[model samples]
Structure formats: C-alpha cells, structure tokens
Target: MEFLQPTSWTDALAAKAASPEAVPICGGTDLMVELNFDARRPAALLDLTKVADLAQWDIDDGSVRLGAGVSYARIITELSARLPGLAMAARTVGSPQIRNRGTVGGNLGTASPAGDAHPPLLAAAATVEAASVRGTRLIGIDEFFTGVKRNALAADELIAAVRIPLPVGPEQFSKIGTRNAMVIAVAAFAVALQPARKLVRTGIGSAAPTPRRAPAAEQFLAGALAEHDLWESRAELPGPLLDRFGDLVTAAAAPIDDVRGTAAYRLHALGVMARRTLAWAWRQYQSASPEGS
Candidate 1:
C-alpha cells in the first residue's frame, strides 16, 4: 500500500480530495490492527502525524476544540479539569502505552460500539468537525454514528477536531470489563448534569449498535429534578427516581450475545452503571456551592 505524509492541513486536505480511498492515520491504534489482520487493505495510507493542525487543541468561546490527533495522555493531563468525564474515560483506554498513542478522533473514526471514548463524548454532547477541500461542517455526536463500525463522514472528509461544551456541573463515567485495563468494555455508561440548562444527559456504550445518548432517561430525570426543585435545592436523588432512570437507560440498548458477553449481562451492567454514575454525579453537584457550580 502507498503511504502519503502531508505536513500541512491544506496539503492533507488536498491529498484526501485527490485520493478519496486513502485512509487517514493518526495514532494508528485501530488502523494498524485492521491492517495487520488483513481486515482492510486500503489504496493508500494518509499519515496525519506531521499535520500540526490535527495535533493541537484550544478552547474557543464556550467549547474545547480538541484536535483529532491529540493523544489520550494529553487529555488526561491537560484537559482533565475541563473535560473530566472524557478524562475519566480516557484513563480506561488500553494501557499506558496505548493511552499515549490512542486518540478520541481514532475512536470516533473506528466507530466501535465498545469504544470507551464514545460514551463520554455522547454524554458531553460533543460535535465532530469534518473538513475537506470543499469546506468544513460540524456533525453532531448523536448523528455521527451510522451503524456498527460505521460513521457519517464523507469519503473526502477528515475529522478535524471534536468540540465539547464546557461542563456546567458534575460528570461521571463507568464501565464493566473482564479486566480493569486493556480489555474492551462489556458495557459502559456516562452521565453529565447540566444544571444551568436543567439538563441531565446520559450515554451508553457496548450495549447498542452505536454509542448512544439515553434521551428518555435524560428527560425523565430532568423532569423529575425540575418537579422537585432538585436542581436548585441540591436535594439527594430519590432512589425510585434513580431506579427508573436506570431502567430507562437499560431499555435504550439493543445488545446481542457476543464472545465478550451476553446481551442480558450487558443490559444488567448498563443499569447498574447508570444508577451509580448518576448518583456519583449528583453528589458532586451537591458538594459544590452555587458559586463553585
């Protein structure tokens, strides 16, 4: 296979437009495996490491624009405070070496249902920045995934960055795996409490065809919190409300029996994680004073 290395963003875009079949490679964490296993043999490999724009990140307005090539390690160290839920999820990605190389952009590109980054991104309501010689456009995280191992990216477009809004309150992420590190998730869940907007968003992974937000659960919990003035009172989350929220999260999934786990186990794990994460996030929200919030 041919390898093309472009040092500038413009050059990269030109190269991609010229060779639509060329696969872009940043960390190569996922793409290398596919190549090694003969699972994919693309016409060309577009090496993006030298493209400086794709490896940088900055906060713009009220959002953090994370470049596609930024490593998991950077997210943990540099962005932890701003993007806690993503940092927490990043910590669980493979090992130290893998974390040093793997990236959220790669996770989105792979579009794996079990990808650790997806849940947090979904929960954070992140957006994917897609670019080409034609122009650039933003794809909502909810609409980015098309199917198992599929995404909405056009043939000529490359993921430029992910834009995640600054957190308004607490966020939490949890996953069930055979082992603590380096193992794929059996199921994963994330919750973010956006008190300023009176929103409670959730994300579920490994229990669905695509990483997805628990909209029904979010609506139920948000409405419940509003009904009780819990958002302002910082009241303890009611057990029954938490239970119903978990049930709704479980209901959103459409898992199947696979080598890693059974559908029933995934469903059970999702419910447990949902309740636990929501509880943890709520406690964090409660502990912070309104000014701190």
Candidate 2:
C-alpha cells in the first residue's frame, strides 16, 4: 500500500480526484479500527493531517465554519460558545485520547448512524462543503447521509469544511449507552431552538438507519412556541406539550434490536431523551433571562 501526505487542500483534492479509492485518513480513529479488524485494506492512504487548512476554523457572517480535520477536543474547548450543541455532543464522544484525535471529518466520513456528531449537526442544519479536481459543492445535513455508514460524498470529493448557522437560542444533546464514556450510543437525540427563526429542530440518532430530523415534532413545537410567543413573558412550557413532543420524537425513530440494545428499549429511550433534552434546552433559555437568573 502507498501513503500520500497532502500539505494543502489543493494537494489533497488532487490526490483524491486521482485516486478516489484511496482511504482518506485525518485522525485514523474509525479507519484504523476497520483496518485492525481486517474489515478494510485500501491500496493507498491519503493522509490529510498535514493539511493545515483542514484543521483551522472561523466564525463569520452569522455562521460557523469548521474545518474538516478539526478535532473533537477543539470543538469542545474552542467552539463550545459558538456551537454548544455540537460541543455537548463532542463531550459525549470517546475518551480524552480519542477526543483529541477523532475529528468531525472522520465522524461524518464513517457516516455511522450512531455517531454522536450527526444528531447535533443535523439539528443545527449544517452544510458540508466538498471539493475535488472537478469542483466544489455544498451538501446539506439532511441530504448528506444516504444510509447507514453511507453518505452523499463522491469518491473523488474531500470534505473541505462544515458550515452551520450560529445558534440563536438554546440547544442540548443527549444519548443513552450501555456505559457512560467511550461507549456507542444506544439512542441519541439533539434539540435546538432558533429564536430568530422561531424554529425548533430535533435530530434522532442510533434509533434509525441514519440520523434524521423529527420534522413533524419540530413543526409542532415551533407552532406551539409561536402560539405562546416563545414563552417570552415568563410563561413555562406546558407539561402536555412536553409529553406530546416526546411522543412525536419517538415516532420519528425506526430502530431494530441489536446486541447493544433492543428496539423497544430504544423507542422508550428516544422518548425520554427527547423530553429531557428539550427540558434542558428550555431551562438554558429560561436561565438566560434576567428574571429567571
């Protein structure tokens, strides 16, 4: 096997466009596991860590642009203020070592449905920028994942960056696993409220073939908020609304029984996670107000 180290994005793009079958590695968190398990053996490896551009990030014009190779640790430490939902999800990722090495690119590149990053990214309505020798294109989070362990990225394309509109309000992420840290999610969920847009978006993971949004639930919540004027005047969220929202989120998942968990349990957990995450986000919003503070 051959190894190619790219010093720049252009170099990586050129290499990828030329050798589309080469395995692209930034941190090797997921790819190495496949390699160690004899599940994958590529003819070549395109190492992307040397490309500095892929590890840098910036915030501008109401959006956060995260370089593909930016580590989960950076996301938690450097970007938590700007992207709290993603940061919270990042904290729930593997161990400290894994967090320092594992990146957003690898998380999306593997495209595992249970990946913790997806739900937050989905809730944030992120867009993935991809480039190749051919050209560049932006793929929305909703359309990015085609199926389990699958994505819309072309073989010749490399993920350049991921852009997400800055959070305008409260957000939170939750996941249930067999154990606390370093464990894969049995069921995970993310909820974000965009006050400016009056949008309430929820993303469900592990309980589906791919991380997916609960559009109906989001619409329902958004409508409710609109009716109540987003509880702007110290009004609390009604318990009935919370229950309905949880039910709607549970209805969005399509899980199957597996060694990690059962379909019934996953559905139950999705409901609980949805309710808890929503409550947490709402608490954050309430705390942000002077009266509540």
Best by lDDT: 1
Give a tens-digit lDDT track for model 1, residues 147-185. Answer: 999999999999999999999899999989999989899
Can you tell me which runs of candidate 1 are displaced by over 4 Å?
Answer: none
Shift of residue 291 alpha carbon in model 1, Å = 1.6
Which model scores highest in TM-score?
1
Candidate 1: residue 74 lDDT (0-100): 97
Instruction: Quote each prediction's TM-score.
Output: 0.99, 0.97
**Backbone clash count for every predicted candidate, in the order shown:** 0, 0
